[model samples]
Every structure is written in structure tokens, then in C-alpha cells.
Target: MSAPETTTTTALMPMVIGEHRIAVEALSVLEILGPQQWVAIPNTPPMLPGALAWRGRAVGVLDLGPALDLPTLSAPSTRNRNAILQLTDDTVALSVDRVLEVCRAAADAIAPVHAASWVVDGGLPCRGEIELDELVVPILDLDAWAVASRRAR
Candidate 1:
């Protein structure tokens, strides 16, 4: 008999934004912080309304609501959290509703995003979708988001 095939699994951190369930690469996440006070900048895009101080540096806050066509987040509360993501050339905080425990799944389990509305500028920042415990979760692609965000500015 041939050798048993070894499946490759990837670490993912599940999070909630508005009513959407999504996940991010666990390796790319630097830290997760509770409700943080941010300084809102005037004349900025709705997706990027503010910045917060992190490790003595001003890190821009990214709100995925507008990007995903979801309603804007309300005032910060106990349930709100910011996930610091390490991008190619910078680090930014992603505002999320709630963060769930990290989980692992086979890499092939992810399927392409079927919702075309999620695409921005010819690309969607979502890597794909994966089903976990009967729930489908979209995987966030930070690198793609960073590139699209830069192009928007």
C-alpha cells in the first residue's frame, strides 16, 4: 500500500464583524486588545476612520464593516476588540466585534468566495471560506486588503 497522505493544516483565528463570521491567519496576528480609545481623523475614509497608539507608534484602525457592506460599528463596548495585524510593511489594528478561539484546518478546506459583492477593486481581501462546525467562515486576506487600501488612498 502507498504511504498515507499527510494533510497540511493552517492556524486560523476566528472573529466576528457585524453579522459576518470571518477568520484570519493566526501567524499574521500580532496581538488582540480590548476596547481601545482611538483618535478619529477628519476627512478620512469610512473604512479607516481613526488611529490608535500601539507600542509607541500610531497604528491605523481598519473597520471591515464598510468594506464588507455591513453597517458601521456602534460605540465601543466590552465586546469590542482590536486585532493587531502584521502586514508586509506596516502594522494596523482591525476593529472586530468579538474574537473566538484559534483553530486548525486543512488548507484545502478553504473554498473560493462566492459573493462577488465582497470584491473591491478587482480583488477581494478574503482568501476563501471554510466550514467549521457547521458554520462557514470567510478568511481575511490582509495582504490583499493592504494593497487595495493603499490604492484607494
Candidate 2:
């Protein structure tokens, strides 16, 4: 007779864009929201898609898929949703199909990625411990992204 061993599972926050999958640490996310009509910001870069009035505060919404120039989602309802995140001192929102789950993977599970166009942290082009499709999605540097948007003006 043998005894069974126990296995532990960690929670990971999941977001979807079409068939692709994106998962991050649940603690990294602040809130998950449903579809909301975002007012598009004109003359802004393709990355800075729009802004929404949240609790009397105007927060910029980033189109993660589009900002990376990835395929667009098919459904209009899916396109209208947003994922709110508190990165650094900024409270920015990301438009995603659905906020799936808050599941977890081991820290060693994530591997590094290489690409100049994709920026992960302030360090050289490398993917983080998060798995986001086959392509590397840059970790949002809210301060830098906001600063770049300002410079674009």
C-alpha cells in the first residue's frame, strides 16, 4: 500500500484575445471589468487607443493586441471590454476579450524571450516569467508608456 502525495497549485490571471492566451499573476491585476464604450483619443499613436472616464478620473486605455499589431477579435462585445490595471502610479486599462481565470503556474515555468520591438522591464529585450502566446508581449511600463505618449504630442 502506498500513500498519495499532495500537489499545490497557484492562481494566475487570464485574459484572452481570440484564440491566443495571456496569463499573469493575479496580484499584478487590480480589477476586471466588462464592456464599456471608450472615447477614442484622436491624434494619438496607434498604441494609445482611447480613454475612459473612471470614477471621475480619465484613464488611458491600451489596446494590447492592436498595440502589438496582433489580430483583432471577431465579436463587437468582446472588443468593447477592458481590463483595469494599476501599474506604477498609473491606473491604466487594457481591452481584452474576456477575463478568464486567476490560476497559477510555477515560477520556473516561465522562460525568457528575445526581440527588440518587445520591451520587458527596463532590461534588454527578454520575456518575463509569464506565458503570453508564442510572441512576447512587453510588460507595461506605465510611466514610460505615458511619457512616450506625451512626447508624441
Candidate 3:
């Protein structure tokens, strides 16, 4: 059987990383599961915090805070909930603290910033200079984050 043809639309989902607010591509998300029981992996990268027994599959959990240099949690506490982002063929499920809402913006909305001192500023493809009044949120590059996490291991 042949796969169905589909048209793609661009939209942004508001997500919270620790205290900072950010906007992520809505298409990158799989599902937002509740606080799940996870098994801690030894000697793994801090970004790849651990793995969770999700649907009989060992889903690699990415700690958004640590991955983005935000404050680390006191412990592995997912008591509230998390947004699971499917990155790179949905093989990895990244966990974020909260989901604010979804909004739409133009691709040209992203602009480059001049500051190149900070590591994140340097690494980002676009600096995101102009802030949207209704959808102003930090842009996160999951690909870069995943790579950094692996190298940190």
C-alpha cells in the first residue's frame, strides 16, 4: 500500500523550560504523557537524563532543564507532568516541564541576534532578535541540544 499524501502547515507550541518560556514546532511533538515511572541509567549524558518504560519500549528521556542549562531539579520528580517531544524519527522522547499553548508565526519571524558571546547565542542558526507581542517565546534547537547532550556524556 502507498502512503497517503499530506500537506504540511507550520505552527508553534508554547512550552515552558523551568521558568523560561519558549516556542517549539508543533510538528515535533508526539504525545504529552503524565508523570511516568523511569529507570535511571548509569554513566549516561546529563542531557539524556534517563529512560522511561513507555509502552513496553525503553523511551530515552531528555531532561529539558539540564539540556538547556536551566536549574536542575532536586531529584527525578515528574510528579506534575511533561511534554514528550519526538525527535529524529521519534526514537527519542524529550521531557519538558509544561505546555503553555499553541500559536502560529511566519518562518521569517525568526531573526538573527548580534550577541555572539554566549554559547547558545553562538550555536543557534538564527538569533531570534525580534520578539512577537502575542507569541514571543524562546526558540529551541532540539538537534543541537541532542548533539550537545551526547557529547556531554
Candidate of highest TM-score: 1
Error of 1 at 30 (Å): 0.8
lDDT of 2 by residue, 44-88 (tens): 656565677677887777665654447633322336457777756
* True-vs-predicted CA distance for residue 92, candidate 3, Å: 3.0
Q: Estimate each model's TM-score.
A: 0.85, 0.64, 0.71
Clashing pairs in 2: 10-104, 11-103, 11-104, 12-102, 12-103, 12-104, 113-127
How many steric clashes between backbone atoms does each model show? Answer: 0, 7, 0
Show pairs that collide, candidate 1: none
Candidate topping lDDT:
1
- Which tens-of-lDDT digit does each residue in 8-100 have in candidate 3? 435777666666566667777777777776767788766566777766787777665653567643345553455667666445655667775
List where candidate 2 sits over 4 angstroms from the true fold. 1-11, 68-80, 114-153
True-vs-predicted CA distance for residue 83, candidate 2, Å: 1.1
Candidate 1 global lDDT: 0.79
The digit string of per-residue lDDT tens for model 1 on 1-153 reads 999999999999998877777888999899999988887777777877778888999988887777667776543422389999998977989888899999998989888876422543334467888897687777888888778778888
TM-score of candidate 1 on Cα atoms, chains taken together: 0.85
Ranking by lDDT: 1, 3, 2
Alpha carbon lDDT of each predicted model: 0.79, 0.57, 0.60
Q: Candidate 2 at 59: error in angstroms? A: 0.8
lDDT of 2: 0.57
Q: Report the poorest 10 consecutive residues by lDDT, candidate 3.
A: 116-125
